[model samples]
Target: MNFILFFIVACALTFSLFREILKRGSDSILLTVWKFFSYYTTLSNFLVLIWFAALAFLPSSEIGQFAQNANVAAAITFYILTVGIANYLIFGWPKLSVYERISDLSVHAVTPVITFVYWLVFSEKEALQYSLIGYWLIFPISYALYTVVHGKWSRFYPYEFTNVQVLGLKKVALNAIALSISLVIGAASFILLGKTVGRL
Candidate 1:
């Protein structure tokens, strides 16, 4: 199961990354690399890599629980990215090829579902805590700040929600606050679910 999860995530990462490089260029890849790292989806996938590695190599009752926390956090980010992208598509973004759609769905949709199920069935749920949600916000907050500062110089924002130029600083701050609140709620819900199911 760990191998399967690893394979799926590896495929998604490779597909999304190579497509970016191909469509964007070899010499100009730095911008694409920077933009890719700026995304929550990319960060979440990196967490999934850690989770997968721990599952494959770590002792079940030892380090695996620690890795489960990473998975829970990653699942939240993946679902958030999925919803955000769905909204983007609803607003009439051009349709993509089937492979592109599959790659997108693999990261944004499938990864979340699989990770959640993996947590539910295999993870030591007692390890998850509501307080960890506070830590989870740090990445998103730092990324938002970087996006705004970088946009001032590069004139590009990776996501519409963080585009300070078009939305203004106040609007961008509000969006960030709203997303932080959502992350708290989502992380809390997962923690509660883990506690409840662990008793069963």
Candidate 2:
């Protein structure tokens, strides 16, 4: 299943990237690629791709072992689930070409669901800790910081909430705080769920 998911995610990511590149029609493919990868959805999907690949082919390797850690797995699950939920709440469903629809569903919906299900069913729950929620938060916080700094330079923010130019620093800071609180709640829920399931 891990291998199969790896293949599916790889295809989805590749299709999305190529479609983005073609849509941009930029002479500088590198710039297009960089902009494409700047989105949280893209980064989350890419993380899952690397994770599934590690689980499928390198179970005994260091990275695979790291991926298998219960806290790490839950963190990945939350991040990907955020991708789907945030997309729906913020963007809703826009009409798209068939290829665009496929890519969107794969990354934003299918991957998050399957990844969470995989973690819930297979991940070792014994190691989950409340303290680790702080650690799990590092990725999103760092991404938020990166987005603000990068957006300032590039005049491009992937999400409207994070767009400081239009929203101003105060609004963007408030948005970040809200998101951080939500993530804390979400991570706590995951830890509790893991403990409950582990007891069974």
Candidate 3:
């Protein structure tokens, strides 16, 4: 049942991504692909897509070991953002209707949880290395820079903390700094925990 459900969600996400890519026209595919992957949520979902693909095609293989450390980082970052969103909503609910809430919950909560569980069950402990810890900053930093540059022209920010138009550049930078530090810390902690569990 779980496999069936995950496969369906993965197909949906991949189809959605393909639709987005097709909308880019022949000339802009490269730029459109880059922009789509720039979003943390999309990147996280891409990881989920890969995981689902591996499980479907290579059932005997340890899918989590494919990109063990990077998978760890992505799972950590996804859950961190999930918790951050919950905290943000606590201060004031966003005026989301039932459908929006369900959509958000699936993307923000369900997917991340599945990622973490996949790591716990399928990832090989021997594959994790301390040297890869610094690599965790790649996506977060890239996304931060992209958010700033994209917001400048679009005047739209996905999250409140990174909203330059409203929070101002200085404050947005500060928030990004804080978030980057926290993300690294969270990633490190997860790595340590995964390593310890792998030992057992």
Candidate 4:
């Protein structure tokens, strides 16, 4: 993983983890810190994803301060224009207006496209080696399970590599297994990691 990318994602993840700390504090100090964080980080997935893409593929710079700002700005821009708008349109702009009827379905529509764009742009064969269990396998399995159970064919499709297999059960099963384990692991390292991380 790129150091810049890792830094921003870790920052974003920290912000996400501390969201309740920001919301529920009662001190001026907490409020000040919260405001600063929210202002500087902007707390957008788009921004973190920009860093992810930069880390995965972009070359390192002697001075990356401007590039860092540019990534966050790009995230804010995309979030406002595309994903944010889609969210508003699908659910209407009421305060927390997520009725069960529309909430699950809309997430299905939104998450995959966003995830796809992020994965397509940022994910690397090398990076996949490190976080394949988190990034690659769990997502496809959960997505397939959700689509199968909910029976809603959102515009997003999981498992792009074997997505075209319209063959019989044997061929589909073979492809599934192949795709699942084709992370090109060196011996039993992933297995050891999987044992420690617990199943995907």
Please give the CA lDDT of all the candidate structures. Answer: 0.70, 0.90, 0.63, 0.39
Collision pairs in model 4: none
**How do the predictions measure up, each by TM-score?**
0.80, 0.95, 0.68, 0.23
Measured with C-alpha atoms, the lDDT of residue 179 in candidate 4 is 41
- Which candidate leads in TM-score? 2
Q: Which ten-residue region of model 2 has the weakest summed lDDT?
A: 19-28
Per residue, candidate 4 scores C-alpha lDDT tens digits across 108-187 of: 23332443354334433121134333332443344344433332233222223223334444664576577446432321
Comparing 2 and 4 by TM-score, which wins?
A: 2
Please give the lDDT score for candidate 4: 0.39
**TM-score ranking from best candidate downward:** 2, 1, 3, 4
Best by lDDT: 2
Model 4 misses residue 102 by how many Å? 34
Instruction: Give per-residue CA lDDT, model 3, range 1-200, as digits (tens).
Output: 33664675565455545655766676477776666565566666665666555555665666544534455544553444544354445545567766555554555566666666666665665556557757667767877788888888866565678788888889988888888788767766776877787788
Error of 4 at 1 (Å): 13
Give the 10-residue window scoring lowest on summed lDDT in candidate 4: 123-132
